[model samples]
Target: MDADTADIATIGHRIRHFRTRTGLTLEQVSDGVGLSQSQLSMIENGKREPKLTVLQSIASAIGVDLATLLVAEPPDERTAYELELGRAQASPLYTALGLPVVRPTKGTPTPTLAALVGLHRELARQASKAIATPEEARRANTELREWMRARDNYLPDIEDLAEEHVKASGHVSGALTHREVSVMAKHLGFELVYVNDLPKSTRSITDLENGRIYLPPASIPGGHGLRSMALQALAHRVLGHERPESYAEFLRQRMQINYFAACCLMPRSAAVSFLQEAKKDRDLAVEDFRDAFGVTHETASLRLTNLITVHLGMRMHFLRVGEDGALYKGYENDGLPLPTDVTGAIEGQLVCKKWSARDAFTQTNRTTELYQYTDTPAGTYWCATQTGRGDDGGFTVTIGVPFADAKWFRGRETTARAVSTCPDPTCCRSADASLETEWADRAWPSARLHAHILSPLPTGAFPGVDDAELYSFLAEHSGPLGE
Candidate 1:
């Protein structure tokens, strides 16, 4: 069968599998689906093609996302939708929802994208009407959850496909040059008209039957560099007889292509192997790994998280400083269980603090305690840091794992400031006296503080560490590392 037909067949099989698993009779399923039994049978048999809406309904009935049904096997054509889904799957949103965000699959309709768009529209309408009722809010939240789930699943696939296509056809081949192609087209009686001053917003190139070119605003450049790139892109398309119609479409395709490239760059087997080696070496530094893999720092960091969380079955979280100097990008729980935006030294300022106090901090297998303060509007955070880096890069990639238990901080009521009472304390030092003066100056309310404290683990009890050698050492020496 052709590629598209094979996709349809795989989808049909999945639908049938879900239906069978649910133990619904053909008549019962058809009745629930509002389709004739014969029609349902034909769909299940791949003898008939179902409309997108019908397919969605069938998937919903089976308690699976529509995209899940559509993505039966990886598509041969490698479209934008596939790439977007792949990238979206890598997002923390997908992890939070407990869904398979990233997996190989053929071309499919993005249920997540459709859901997000629909939710956005609904939210806009509700906002315009000033939805005041609790019922409305609850319903909105439900729809939002569904949209989030779909977006978490589909957007990555779209990105992957687009990136792949752009890389494949946008660039001139090894022997061919843009000038040569332009000259060749002219020789074939086609006009070699170059639009150098196209708008910077141009996105895609389209070929009219009359031989006129239509380029989206986003794809065009504000100056010569972009103009050259656009011309080259257009020239490549002219030679290939293919081009995306809009900038958004072009971006969507580009992202898809990028997703595929990332996958190809970090194939599952290779990624797994790298994770095993990293685990063996106990190296968690993203920058060092990026150098080894020839990937960007950001990609390396994300891949490291994925390796530990997905492949190694370890709980990991990523924290990054936002442009606004706020806390963001919290994932998996590297022991800080608090919300991402919660203001504190440990929340957004961990890395900077580590960088500043790098000399004082010692790398040891034993748990070490460290304390730092958060600036006013938010109080100080006294937390312990667990420092470990892989030996490969001479400690270039450092993983400063933090531990904060709410109970421990709450126990130190006299020392700790509530988030509401002093949202941001200017100085955490007891000698500063400003915080004490401020406390005495204002009417201190009986405020509740959210605290996170790290629980100490037994020495030499690392989860991923091999126990056989450690046990053998203990049996022979009758003592631990401290002894």
Candidate 2:
């Protein structure tokens, strides 16, 4: 009936149930309890809290123990429906709608009660879902990134698993072949199947019962190739991930699978040895690393992030920035301070325009990687950014290290360098004095916003996937496995 009485609604329902079961009328119970009949009715309807003596007298009059009336569960399915309806009507969302609350009677159909309860549940779910703001998502992402950073971005256990699986696939070389990936899948009791009608929300779907992994036949732009994606799907099973219940868990699982994929493609011992040789030659280059591993530049850069610090004795930083200067992903144990929001999230925060990650977009040499040294408040750092076009737009994958470590890397002595005192607006974000004065009041520029930056992370156990669509896809595809 009201917020104050919401907690005791179940108690009211129980009292009514026990009273009716004993065939005691409201008037009879009130008479025995020495309260007005209206008072008894109010208590039964969850509109009033009867005193301890009044409750004792009611229990005595109804021939039941007080504990029985105080039990948590509704006495029956019908009472459950009534309790749910009362809760819905008492909620702030319902009251704020300014709609008349439905008071169900004995004559009200069971279907009507069921429908109202279902609608109320959906309303509450939607309300809760909306409350998961971008800030919450960023905080989750930031925390997960911090957790990864804590271990120097190296997971020896995961690395061991990747090495064992790769060796099992009979892989002893450079790039992990598609055939080797298939071998690993077969070794793990999974078969890779390509389907055109895969769910849009999912990259790869594993039907565990049927021992199949369904993927798209076509390659996705700015995404992992078939081998990497397959390895990732297999990684899920290897890592023992169930459906994630929160955004943080989802991010972690995603990172783990990607990490596993990287480790598989570039096994720990081999990749580190390759880097060691590159360092000996004073010619560490991300492009050569990408070429050697036959993986994307971003993938190579990320793999380097995992190994360079732990194995190569070099503190480093990696950044993936969009053409619009938004920092899409970043990691650093070196002192290059990434711009962070109040929540310590780096994604969606703008990288300094003076940084090589942003300036690479202006470079005329599209075929070659752009390398530069940036002088920041922290120190001078040498970075190489490779600009590429994706389905969304242009982006850059940059890997960098402190000036001291630059001696071991290629492109260490380039004339291209700039100063950045970022995390300060005047460093890059603010317009020049003449430009600001001329158009500060005249400009009414509309911001081109990314929808994901404002929207909540998708709701449900698996986060962004549609359960019904995935289940149907799995069922449709599983029939062939039996054959």
Candidate 3:
């Protein structure tokens, strides 16, 4: 209504945001500010008008300034667009879009101010959606992953940009070299520093302000790890990845950066040519590519999948699991069943112990390859996986193709057949009778590394990346990762 009412509303909103952000309850704020919890809640819900003294007391209790509590940020172009979009989407005109109609919150709705408050409430509701509920995150991730799989996980535009950058940096094919990275870093006005103690969960930290990129010293000794790390960090800048506004946008950006890094290391044209030659003998393998190119097994495995899916037009699936058989990442276009949660997500689900990925983890003195043929409700498929350890932890990477498509790979000879009825009781791996009979209550599966797998990541972007560690690092150094 009036300026005073608007300011009171803004103060209430800010106080609520701060309290929620700091994990403080209404009771705690009320107790500290000498107000009843009901009064505090009413103020927070914009149903009660609070005095200046009350606002100041609440601000002090929340560890923020009185002015900050009263003044709301003026929405920029993007925010204004989102607010308008939310308001419009809430209307009947855009009902087909299926976004929930933001109901007007109860209070007196003055003719003119009612519309503004309705829009404001709708904007608040939409802004909260950006944080993502668990279901929202799961659905968004599944949709994005499916979208990537539908396109065969190959982004031609991103590939072209990466290839152009590589050529411009003076590298002429094969795998990208360390020298190329150094040259590009210099061109981008960056100096690389190999630090031994750069946070356990972090691989590399880019200090754009200081014009220095920090790499774990371990990445430098061998394995072309240094180049991969440098290129990934540089990809954020070269690709102009924006600050992620939501979980889905964050996942898309991370995938783009990874795609860019992979393209730089294994050029699309060169990789397609190599695959064309290598597949002639039915000998296509990640190890073969790893040796042919100067990349690690993990990189080679991902690169091969990228090429085979896009270039060869074969639907495939890739899975990465730990020694404990937890699925770290998985993608499939082939109609083969993989373990998944109730929400139909493959990630974070425990792999069927009989599956090739888990089998690879148990092999003593395991060779560079482990292959298995699995039969599921959809059909039979053949998978080849390799187990490896790294700074973060140990993991196994498996690539599977439909039975019809397995003829193109060497692992087709393996008769190690298994049937998987995943997320089903009759499935040999998940059968309670089978497991209880074998271990008889003696086995332990490590209590399921909860790790907030089902919850929305606090940073609201980058599905698997540890944004908290990066934030802590940046806070310590007084620097920002991305604007």
Taking the tens digit of each residue's C-alpha lDDT, what string does model 1 give over 1-483?
334333555666677767777887788878878999999988975679899889888988877888777764633323233434444554554455575444433244466554544554564554333422333323333343234233331243433432343344333222223344344334333433343333333332323333433333433433222233334434343334234442223333443333344443344445567666765665434445555545554445555544454466554344443322223333333443332222222332323322212312443432332233222222233322222333221111222232222222212222322222222233221335775677767765773322211212121212112346434433543332234
> How would you order the candidates by TM-score, starting with the best?
2, 3, 1
Q: Which tens-of-lDDT digit does each residue in 1-483 have in candidate 3?
A: 335333444556667778877899888989999999999988975579988888889989988887777664421332233334444655553574565655333342434344655665676676567666677767777888789888887788888988787887899866678778878877778877766567766778887777877887744567477787888888888888777877778777777888888888888888888888878877788777887778887788787768787688788888889877788788787876777777777667787877888888778856668889988778898999888887667889898899988888887888789888775665755446666698967766756554656666543344345766777775675554334
Candidate 2's residue-wise lDDT over 299-362, tens digit each?
Answer: 8999999999889999999999999899998999997899997778888889999999999888
lDDT of each: 0.42, 0.87, 0.75
Regions of candidate 3 where Cα sits further than 4 Å from its true position: 1-136, 195-212, 218-223, 391-393, 429-446, 460-483
TM-score per model over all chains? 0.30, 0.76, 0.66
Which 10 consecutive positions of candidate 2 have the poorest summed lDDT? Answer: 1-10
Instruction: Name the lDDT value of residue 207 in candidate 1.
Output: 33
409: Cα error in model 3, Å: 1.9
Pitting candidate 1 against candidate 2, the one with the higher lDDT is 2
The candidate scoring highest on lDDT is 2
Give the C-alpha lDDT of model 3: 0.75
Q: Tell me the TM-score of model 2.
A: 0.76
Q: After superposing candidate 1 on the true structure, give the runs of residues whose Cα lies further than 4 Å from its correct spot.
A: 1-261, 322-324, 338-483
TM-score of 1: 0.30
Clashes per model (N, Cα, C within 3 A)? 72, 0, 0
